[model samples]
Target: QIVRAGAPYYLPAKIAEHVSMVGELLQFPRLVPKKVISVGSPVKWANSCDARGCANLVTPSVIAQRYKLPDESLPAAHQAHTSNSMAVAEFQGQFWKKSDLDGFGTSCHRDVSVAKTIGDEEPHGGIESELDIEYIKAVAPEIPLTVIYNGQFSLLKWANQISSMADP
Candidate 1:
């Protein structure tokens, strides 16, 4: 029941027309947001979750020890970036679904691949971050997870391509 006409015109007939148009359009297919979970580095996870002590939740070293993964599977957990930190809050999924995600956009495409390292590679926030994976495994091992990453494309290039393809 949206009315585009203002008081200056105060045309009741026009308001009815606008309402009818809106009602008709409502019957068309509407886009509903999808929900997915992801993990990230301790600092990134903490900052995203706005939790102060997320780093302390878990580390790659802990995951390695718990799951018997190879020592080379992750960077040193004691590094300045991996030190004691708070765990990413569980409520992040809802926030992320509605958030612009620091201008990275809200859509997730399957075309990308997840990488083990962040060097020279396009940055992805979800499952691409190693610490994020470790935290997920540590906090909730029961939930199935799928990680995607693509090292060939830079973030800006990927965004540009998506934008261009969508343009008229």
Candidate 2:
């Protein structure tokens, strides 16, 4: 409560000095409540916890087929996304297991290039980055993919790096 009251006076100044954007202020994050449930059990979408019903299961092939591929060549058959700055105490970036990717049916990917992970302790931290890669790879198998983890804790740095990229 004190922070919320004081944020109006101090946050703007601090943000102006060091941050390019302000998000999730004065509000709790929207996340699903983690709970143990039997496999294949009924589930509710989003942040709901009540066992309302089973979640819709869509096969990767079906998802891939649902959308048509672009007629134009896919940027030399390459797909990529940049990982933004993670919070302090958060996991550093780390590559997902190749076996998991294969299990997800992305076996067609010849190789994945991860940039800007030379000094990262974990290289790639969460499944989010891995999932991002897997989703694209699953949808468009055989496409070369790149996972660029922005280890910096500042969006401005990531922005600058992206701006400096010749082909993004």
Candidate 1 runs further than 4 Å off: 1-129, 156-168
Tens digits of lDDT, candidate 2, 101-125 = 5544433322332333322445223
Among the numbered candidates, top TM-score falls to 2
lDDT (C-alpha) at residue 150 in model 1: 35
Report how far residue 41 has shifted in candidate 1, in Å: 24
lDDT of each: 0.34, 0.45
- Clash totals for all models, in order? 15, 7
TM-score of each: 0.20, 0.42
- Candidate 1 per-residue C-alpha lDDT over 1-168 given as tens digits, one digit per residue, 9 for 90 to 100: 443434343338858765422222122345587866766554422122323453554443345456775444235522324232232221112112112332221121111122222123332344334344444533333333333333443444444433454321
User: Judged by lDDT against the true structure, how good is candidate 2?
Assistant: 0.45
Alpha-carbon RMSD, each predicted model: 17.9, 10.0
